[model samples]
Target: MRATEHWPVVVIGGGQAGLAMSHELKERAVSHVIFEKNRIAHSWRTQRWDAFCLVTPNWQCRLPGHHYPGKEPHGFMPKDEIVSYIEDYAKKIDAPVREGVAVKKLSRNGSGYRVETQEGTVTADQVVLAVSAYHKPKIPALANDLSASIKQIHSSEYRNPGQLPEGAVMVVGSGQSGCQIAEDLHLAGRKVHLVVGSAPRCPRVYRGRDAVDWLDDLGQYDLPVDKHPLKDGVRGKANHYLTGRDGGRDIDLRRFALEGMILHGRLLGLEDGRLVFGDDLTKNLDAADAVYNGICTMIDKHIESQGIEAPGQAHYRPVWQPEIGAESFDSVQAGITSIVWATGFTSDWSWVDLPVFENNYPKHERGITPEPGLYVVGLPWLYTWGSGRFVGVGRDAAYIADHVADVSREKTAVPVASRKETRPWHGLDGYNLASAVA
Candidate 1:
């Protein structure tokens, strides 16, 4: 039998979150390793479209000690540049990352964790799951029913217009990815059919500054999930649609509709060789516009309240409206030769053999779970709106590192046998403390 290696802390990811955690752990002199299935910044390099860029400005690229160093503080970095930024941060921190080592299982091992990776098993006093929630691309079940000749592809696989078969492209879901991908196809002069969802929209620039800048000033990003009106429910909300392409600009679905883009409602499924859609196209569009104007209204109030001299702005006015859209259309007749499912992703935590999840969602107060030494970071709305983004992941990482350090101190101060008697660690409802400690 191979002897299991051990470390004080083990982080399972090599993205910005894991790198940030490594930096903080190193600062505190905590010996650790980051296990990445692929190379650092793999998602940014492989998953994103060619023209993809940050919707938020480059200044928000604050990952630990590294911040955006380019001349354009407000300009958004394209896909390649974003990858370089993360790679540069990894080099700067000297993070102990083991590339191509996929973690197969994570289970309790005598008051610590047993992380089974492809490379080998390792025991760690603390484990931080820095992998973000987007683990698997979520395509609807209806997709399987669609004719295979339609050339279906998830938004992650989509690269450019030239890659698809010649004909119109139907994009389903209207979240950030769906909207942006639709725009990418439209700009390429491809006939585009978009299935709009309830995802909200935000203006790229408002009141002579980016909407994000105003939101930052308004203390929106700092608002914690616990204090949020929806509480943890905010995590499930689709991100507001906008674009950072070509400097930055608003993604006006209404304008796209006006400019010959066929807009449909929610994808109901396939019916008798035809694609069925709901009649909520107008409703969805109106809801998106409401959010766009709502942000503008909020920014307008902030400017007035702060007595700041900013340019005035008018609320968005819908330039187009659908008139009783068809309930179902033959995709073949409509010339939609390709379909892009921009429908988000789902979390897969099956490898984590612990009872820390409730209904597929990890239950935690920030990154600290009921499983004492097990922590999760880089999750959407982990604490605040910025918890998962570059603007906020470093702060979350720092907090987790501090907790890990404290736990290390406790373990060092107390002997293993005495820890059970003096510090009796209680388990949550579904967890077994005795087994965890054993």
Candidate 2:
């Protein structure tokens, strides 16, 4: 077999973005191969724990022409359901996906890209990096001080409360994951302890509506990350907290905390098999509340400026804000058998050899990177507010495909290997549909 096989494009990471890209390429009659490090929806299968559901509602989860199936399209779906949807998407569109093949290295070869994977090497005129931003977990160093008697797990390893010990549990990080996990454990009849930290809180519901409904009415979903002025200022500062019906009527964290969940100060350290925490639990919670209040203020301003009208302003209760720096955080040394770190994730692209990433982020105009034909998806902020990840990538995928087509038309030569000649099952219609948004 020759070292260089012809393909117009090769996409890395077979997750949502990669699949979407392939669908687009097909429409353009572009010959391409997708290299998935693991099986399709691998992250959904491994990283997310049991009882996990999509934060984005069902209708929003749809990609391009495919809408997530079944009724209640507005409700959240389980992780397994999402994984199945992705697999079905590949099968339905007949996407070219190489399962269990991890791309180890990538480099510029002449005017194209050389992708080295466990299966073999392929040289293509273009490459798309579709790996997600939350590829690695951040485990606190303080967790090491605890003796072997207690279990220590990063949020990535956590599935449900059943994974923890029977006694009191310490949930670190007050972000959405931390809050959700703490709530789950308490509901499972486990004595829970939440180590509070700095974050913005948003009510689970407003009056009789889900928070998502409010976001839709306010055009929050329409805000682009790159173009929006407010997203740039408070991009990753927000956290989800339910206060009313959705927050409490059915499932209440505050009530859970009142009954069994002991709110603790930030987990500072561990000494002699005992946990030591900051004495500022009250202050931290208060600060968290302040962050949330600031977000509501901004949203209100946006609603006014956009001249958007929402239904039932009376039901729109005041956004929940934790009292800043007002209370203290306490720690209990007994019955606490394990510590689950629910802190957020950090990116790991060390395996990706590229000079195009600025401060480890791709330097791209829209979705097109500096490297000719190189693209990235599922980034923290690729284009708009959530451009490269979640339900937002639909627009980003279209933007990239359109740019690729335009660039190709401008080029004189068809590169070393053309997709039309190499791949037998090729079509340009799907690619056109995906890129049509441009």
Candidate 3:
């Protein structure tokens, strides 16, 4: 017979999201445990590239009680620094985290959830799918037709250019990861071909301060996706071409092109001996510029309205580096020996035996699952554009905790004293069960 354990709530995937859920459960005095595939903050430890740093500043990483009290609030935190913070947090909070527990199956039990892992089984009244937003590396199906001789690797597997095969590299997609990898390859003396996409560029700093400051001050970071306009604002919706490279330095694509990167339009598909593209390189570039300008305009207006004399920052007008050429390119003629797919990543729901997906993503409203006792977090645009970011998980975590407390109360008779309890603080972010329970 297999060992069967039970918990009031079981939080899956001990990244920022799962740890956040743990903090919330801890605050509510909820009996919960975190099941991590690896150690705490596993992705930060393994998934990131060698030169990767958070694009956001240090001040934004206000996790549940594990605040960034370091001196460099504005500087971007490196991968190691982030890992250390999370590791320390997991130890300090005493999060009941079971490491190396790979959950093979998560299905519905009688009225709860059954987590079948390599260690054993766990039944929980409530379940949190905080496995993070990105799980599987997204590679286009067209990659199969290309000869295996041309090395291809997703952004997740890529570390440094030295790991790649010799010759010119074609970096598909122009988001932050793609752009950064292209830069890395170019700097390493490898000829790089950057296939620019619809990604917009935002300067790391503006007005002697970070651009994030203006957006955060304007409450843009907290704005819900439903409340936001759809057009010219996709920058906030998807990944943007910006970098925290070299301690939060800006990376402009047009500037990248000026320095010998062979830029191309959106990748259509593989053709006779070349990769096809739509004749939209200039159009896409214009759209990207529009996104950058739109944000600046909003910030400028906010500053003017507040009668604030801000520091002088130079506004930029984009000039096509060597003037973008025709759309299609001969992949073989360009001597592109390798391809880096920085397109994106998606969630893998094979382990999750549930009917909760919509648009190929786990469907939830504010992290609340339609199925009672089920919840999700760490998805982009969950409530705001920052929903999936390091700074945003705490808010969603608190919400999930409240729901868990409510569900737990429903499953059991709540005492009058417990119902009226105001202080639910267990050394986390000081949340009370009474507020959420009511």
Candidate 3 or 1, higher lDDT:
1
2 or 3, which is superior by TM-score? 3
What TM-score, over all chains together, does every model reach?
0.93, 0.81, 0.89
Query: In candidate 3, what residue range of length 10 has the lowest lDDT sum?
Result: 428-437
Comparing 1 with 3 on TM-score, the higher-scoring candidate is 1
Model 3 Cα lDDT, one tens digit per residue, 1-438: 156778888888888888877887888899988888888888888887888788888999878888886898888877799999889888878988989988999999989989999888879888898887687899999899887678999988889988887789999988888888898888788899887787777767777678888767766666655555552243234566677767677776777777777778888898875688766777777777776766666666667777888886656688654454556667767787889999898768889888988666776767787776889888776766667886777887886677689778775534323443121212212111111111
Best by TM-score: 1
**Ranking, TM-score, top scorer first:** 1, 3, 2
RMSD of each: 8.1, 8.2, 6.7
What is the number of backbone collisions in each predicted candidate, taken in the order shown? Answer: 0, 23, 0
How much lDDT does candidate 2 score? 0.66
Error (Å) of candidate 1 at residue 253 is 0.7
285-396, model 2: which lDDT tens digit per residue?
6555554444444445545666766443331232333333333322334677887888887777777677886665567755677677788876655655445545667667
C-alpha lDDT of candidate 1 relative to the true structure: 0.86
Angstrom error of the Cα, residue 97, model 1: value is: 0.3
Error of 1 at 229 (Å): 0.6
lDDT of each: 0.86, 0.66, 0.76
Clashes of 1: 0
Per-residue accuracy of model 1 over 14-54 as CA lDDT, tens digit each:
99999999998998899999999999999999899999999
